[model samples]
Target: MTPHEALDDLTRRGLLRSLKPLPDNRGRLVVAGETWLNFCSNDYLDLGHDPALVAASVRAVEDLGCSAAGSRLVSGHLDLHAEFEAKAAAFLGFEAALLFGSGFLANLGAVPALAGEKATIFCDRLNHASLIDGIRMSGMKWHRYRHNDPAHLDELLTKHPAEAGETRLVITDSIFSMDGDAAPLAAVAEAARRHGALLLVDESHAIGVMGPSSKGLCAAFGLKPDAITCGMGKAFGGYGGFVATSATLAALIVNRARSFIYSTGLPPACVGAGIAALDRFAETRGALGDEAMALAKRMHGLLAEAGFEMPPFASPILPVMVGDNHLAQEFAARLAARRILCSAIRPPTVPPGTARLRLTVTRAHTGADLIAARDAFAAVARELGLLP
Candidate 1:
């Protein structure tokens, strides 16, 4: 199809996406000269605008300039990068960690590096698109197990048993982004062990919010997977990604992960900010995370009391299901009209017929903010015949 035709098709299907440039402000957004309570942000810890993180970033730019200059193998491997990696590894309970340009890049690089053509991967059906793309790039056979179902994963592994000397890998997300639910990590770990498969858990959503000391779900469960990967964009309130693993595996990824080898190192500003965020987490002992979770639970209660269907409270993410694509967009539009800024999540970000408003609660939000949001949601829902 032609570009215009594809655009037309997407518009008809309510799948077209566009970017809206808005000034950065934690927990609230200004659009068309009006302020709205923002529930679409991933900055769970609300540290993106923290003064300390900003100061650290500015210092790094002053010292090292903006860019990393080149790939790490060439010249871009800065001391700041090394420092952050060391700090992240220790914080996440790993022997070593390798940095990536972004979380998507981390998965694209790490997944293929760890699993090759001779490997077979068993993946959760509802994992993020990054993981799906990474598996495809690996050129390995893979099976999709039922979401969060360890029994299904084990059955798939047994059916696709690894050949002698062939690798087997099981991958999952610790906290699902849209559904706001957590995987049963211990059960999944047992399944991986039973099948002699290496486990890789993506903690992008859970890091700095869902585990003891903000270390992540794996740390909370005391299950050490082969590797734990995460993006700093969420709770770290910065940009970049990393994989924490054994020292030997880190070395292997450096040599084999094409995305890491070919891409430029993370910029100095992000590295500095990440380091500062880690220090903040260490100092506070995850008190901010506790606060955010509590706020999310409270928000969940408010919405539930208003008669909106909600997934069980897991992380700060709470999905208000709308089902139909156009209705979801209308719901978001109505919320925006009420000075609430929640995004309508639609396919292929979510499965078809599962469109929703992916509401998120952050440390920056207050009880009053949540109450206002709840009232807005209830009003919109009643108008749309979604609530009594």
Candidate 2:
């Protein structure tokens, strides 16, 4: 289709995407020159604008310059990269960690690298797009079990046994981003163990916001996945991605993963901020995540009592399932008009009819902010005839 036709098509289908310049700080976003209470950010700990992180980034830019200069093996391997990786590995309870430009690239690289020739992959139906892309790029057939349904996964595993000269791999995202629900990692891990298959968990939305100590959901379940992929952009309040695994696996990715071998190294500024976030995460003792979850629960209760339906939420990421895309859009527009801005998520980010407003509450959101959200939601629900 021509560019004009594509634009028209998107507009016609309500699938058109638009950009809004919303500068964020302390759970508030400035959109269209008006400040709005932000419930759409992934900065769960409110550290994106943290002073320490800003200072660290500023210092790194002044001292190390911007780019890594080249790929790590080609003179970009600075002392700071090594230092950051070491710290990241230790912090995440892994033997080693290799940073990528983003979480998408990490999965896009790791999935295929782990897929041995003629491999049989078992993936979750609701895994992130990156994971699906990685599996597809591997050029191997994969079985997708029902979303977070371990019984279905076990059945699939039993039916699709590894044949001669084939390897078995199980991949999943620990936290389902759109639905704000967690995977049954304990059960999946057990299944993988029973089948003698390697497991890879993308903790993109889980790290720094889960686990007993906030290491990740894998740690909380006492499961040691063959590899854990994480993005530093969400709860970390920084930007970058990394895979934490054994030294051997790390070495293999360095040499084999095409995306990693080809892409330039991540910016030093992100590294500095990431290190600072990790340190702060250690200092807080997971209290930031705890507070965010507590507030989410409070909001869920408030909204439910007010007659607005909520998704089955296990984290700060909450979804108001509107079912219809236009209704989701309308709900968000109403909320935005009231100076409370949350995003309306639609296909293909979610299922065709599961359009929703993915409201993410952070620790920085005060009780008053939550009260505004609750009240605004009630008003919108009633106006939209969603309330009885």
**Which model scores highest in TM-score?**
1
- What number of clashing residue pairs does each candidate have, in the order they appear? 0, 0
TM-score of each: 0.98, 0.96
Question: Using lDDT as the measure, which candidate wins?
Answer: 1
- For candidate 1, give the lDDT of residue 149: 99
Per-residue lDDT of 104-200 in model 2, one digit per residue for the tens?
Answer: 9999989988885679899999999999999999998899999999899899999998888887999999988888899999999999999978899
- Native-referenced Cα lDDT, model 2: 0.87
lDDT of each: 0.92, 0.87
Error of 1 at 133 (Å): 0.5
